[model samples]
Target: MTPYENVTFKERLHEEAAKLKEMSFRDKFWYIWEYYKFPIIGVVIAVFLVGSIGSAMYNNRFDTALSCAVLNSRYDSEALTVDQYFDEGFRAFIGLDENTKIDVDYSMSPSFDESAMNEYSYAELAKLTAMISSKGLDVMIGRPDVIDHYGEMDGFLNLEEALPADLYEQVKDYLYPVTNAETGQESFCGIRIGDTSFGEKTGLILEDPVLTIMSNSPHTDTAIQLIRYIFEQ
Candidate 1:
């Protein structure tokens, strides 16, 4: 009922605002945080959830550390036709121990095309390019024409350079010449797994396929091991 009673509503509002402005910086920060804490927490949780989903999708799209795809458009079987017995052998060779068994993603598809993409549609070509760049393709088993096409683009690893000394010796004689698509020059870029062997002394029987490693393959050791097992069998 004294001087405070004389203060009008406008004056009281200004007084409170001035008091707030005069508050310490730390106090103001706490005031703001307390007022908006719920919203801030919600925003943070939303960001975290989005990031988690995005990371999972990215990994699922490109993760193929143990996959080996054989591209042969001539054969259209969706399921793997390779003998399971060899799969068992390769798994045993690559596994860490007796109890720690490994699963191999052996796949075959006839949809692949050369760098020119003469046979693949736009979507198929894009998927193929992505697979190659991501190192998802470990080994490629195809006929001579297909091998030659990829070899020209430097897509396949040079067998002479990639195989171990012992394994190289076993297959060196069977690596047939292929004309590079880019250079128009011939190179020993593929091993003829079909109808040939290392002079028959090794008792290795050849099948009707040419095997090559992708240049960007992450599992070169496994690829070599698989090749070795195939020829040995």
Candidate 2:
């Protein structure tokens, strides 16, 4: 007599299916986990990594602070890195602490090709206006043309109103006055960021940098403090 006379492959398969059906929910879950745990964990990790990278990129682009924004007019072939100019004099001017440091945001003027008139494009202007209105921006550094463009819109803050009496007296010599279009009043618009020597210590100088400040900035006091430091240095 054969030992497997009563048993068949079909019978064994039926028995296994019956055992699976009888399993408790927890047991069934463990059975699946035993087979697929690695793939599940890998998918979860991938999702987390992607989420972290996306958040970092978004913040890097849009997360601006109350900062000194420099809009360069004439492109100089050779220029020192912005860091090169932030020496002891610049540091003291901005009230640098262990936790806080000066932030100078720099940008080139809109090229003629970018905006036929060498001005900000509509979209660019919109974004800039949003930043300015939000007080994310404080100071501006650019040239005459760049200054005139913003000046016409009455975008710049009035030093007379923004600065303390003593502070204004210290930096007024460098300020260029402009008339407000809406109010029809005159005020200092910006300071000339010239190639003029900031003396021997601050060796690196920007080629034709104009310094201006924004109106309605929450950090106007901080901006004035830096301006005072610059002039004093």
| Top candidate (TM-score) | 2
lDDT tens string, model 2, 1-233?
76446879898668667867999989878875686677765665555445535643555475333476665433333553455555345655565653444555455343324446311343344445555765667887766676767777798887767778887776667778777677777778787646344323343335556678887666676777767666665
Give, for candidate 1, the lowest lDDT window spanning 10 residues: 198-207
C-alpha lDDT of candidate 1 relative to the true structure: 0.60
Tens-digit lDDT track of model 1 for 10-57: 998787678679889898778757766667656655554555456435
* TM-score for all models, in order of appearance: 0.54, 0.57
- Runs of candidate 1 exceeding 4 Å displacement: 1-65, 73-86, 96-122, 183-185, 196-207
Per-candidate clashes, comma-separated:
4, 0
Top candidate on lDDT is 2
